[model samples]
Target: MTALPDDLARALDDALDRVPASRLAPVVERLIGDYRGGVATVSSRQGPILRTDDDAAAYAAYRMPATYAAVHDGLSRAAEVVGRLAPRTLLDVGGGTGAAVWAASRLWPSLRAATVLEGSEPVIALGRRLATGADDAAVRAARWERTQLGAATTLPEADLITVSYVLGELPEPVRETLVDEAAARASTVAVFEPGTPAGYRRILAVRERLIAAGMGVAAPCPHDGACPITGDDWCHFAARVDRTSRHRSLKGGTLSHEDEKFAYVVATRAPGQHADNRVLRHPLQRKGLVTLRLCTGDGAIADRPVPRSRREHYRAARDTGWGDAWPPP
Candidate 1:
């Protein structure tokens, strides 16, 4: 019942084997307490999710693993996906803990340089460590900062720009600023978030802005106009993370939660670039296979993906003008 990738699975296994799982929890508990008490910070670009108290909001938000193996795994998966879309230099906006930067660094010859923009003290310190190590064999050096996203911090023209699980904390204006920055330099921008309505909303806003700027959707098109999710809930999807080194310490001896379930929007800079990642569409399998899609109150389609009927599908494609469009069905 584990959802870890090969590397993360082995790392967590080793940690669990070396340190008794039972004993490790306590050690981690203390670490968490210390982290909360201002001794150590998780180094988020956002303000102290955990202050000098014995309770850290960052850990609590992520359910605080004993180690950060799973964190690294998630970062690597995101990095790989984003790298394929825009593989040269990447700008990791609001990069915290440096895990994402570390992941991007592992993309072989694809990744050139990773410039991290952060605004927190503890996180900047950790980023410094990761960035330095990344510099030694890295084709391009790594850089970390304590700068705000809205500051005069301008980045060079990058191939890919990433803002993963970091924008919800910012105000709407700042979110727009980030989208604008991504649009300015990178040929493609990726916005990944937890699978929540709020997350969907954020991606939607980003999708609209980028598309208006002559960009095109690259992933999670959600062709439906409205949220496919029903009963006022939300939509989520799963992505398995492969760990590099720190996997075992955080994931424990066994995996409890599967892969992190988050929604992502990969929008291309140029309009026609959307033609990538497609295959010929074919008829549904299982001869009488019935599919259901969700529809909105106004008969519009929903963007939220929930299990519904073909009616739901019709509403979405209709509203979005998908019309069984070009690349695939």
Candidate 2:
């Protein structure tokens, strides 16, 4: 697992000072219940959900680490496909606790300013506090705005924009409105949601809408046509995050690491080279052959075999991990 960004690591440590794991455990458990009971669903009409101060603190402690890691990885992979890009500004819509901005700042030091738009007061307060001690001047001074999402909402033009883990909580009309707004305001847009089938469906819908809006598919998908993945299979990726002792205590987990599965799409206004194939599953090596399931550039799924007789390719396949662009380096 990759280490958390130094500033974010310090920020999280600072937050832990205000809300210890002991005080955060019950909130984490309650949230788990809400999720399991299917009561955590989002609606467009709903106001700021994390009402209490403790609720906001607990959420930041438990969720921020995994989300930061996921968004960081997503942006890095997207950069690989899009080549060199230096964005001057960023807008993070529905950016609870500002995880996406922290990730973006790490990747794009060229960004002079960043803004986080969120409705929850407690969450926004916590977000401001989290960045209060950051080493980066831009991140430390990032603007946090109290804003709602809808057709009436106006967005600031930015080089890159991210809407992470927020779309699934909105109604269809609102979701469409936000996507359209994002496409209009930014040259690059990235959306992320949970790894569930429902989440994948949301990503697919957003992908189609963005393409229709004249944005090119930049990563994960090689082409801008229809997605080849169908029922029971969703295009998602896994990122391993090391859990702190406090994290383990809050969630009552025995493992030292957790795999966060997420569905995401990064779209750009201009066309770029995409990988010929994306590794859909972990490679399996048996005897003299290695097998890989890949989403080909032509928008079809293929099970490719590389045998030992094909020495160079066989070694490459053996080292390939899931979610990596294929024809491994």
Best by TM-score: 2
lDDT at residue 223 of model 2 (Cα atoms): 76
- What lDDT tens digits, residue by residue, belong to model 2 across residues 1-329? 65677778788888778776677888888866765565666642344557778888888877888888888877877787777667788999999899998888888888789999998898899999988977777788789999878766778888988999888767788889889988999999999988888889999999999888889877778778788988688899888888888888888898998988888898998557577788888788899999989988899989999899998888888888888888852
What residue pairs clash in candidate 2, if any at all? none
lDDT of 2: 0.84
TM-score of each: 0.59, 0.95
Query: Relative to the unseen true structure, what is the C-alpha lDDT of residue 172 in candidate 1, on a scale of 0 to 100?
Result: 74
Model 2 misplaced regions, further than 4 Å: 43-46
Off by over 4 Å in 1: 1-47, 50-86, 105-108, 131-136, 151-155, 222-235, 241-257, 270-329
Global lDDT of each candidate: 0.49, 0.84
lDDT for position 329 in model 2: 23
Q: In order, how many clashes per candidate?
A: 25, 0
How do the residues 142-179 of candidate 1 rate in per-residue lDDT, one tens digit apiece? Answer: 67766766634466677777776667667677788788
The 10-residue segment of model 2 with minimum total lDDT is 40-49
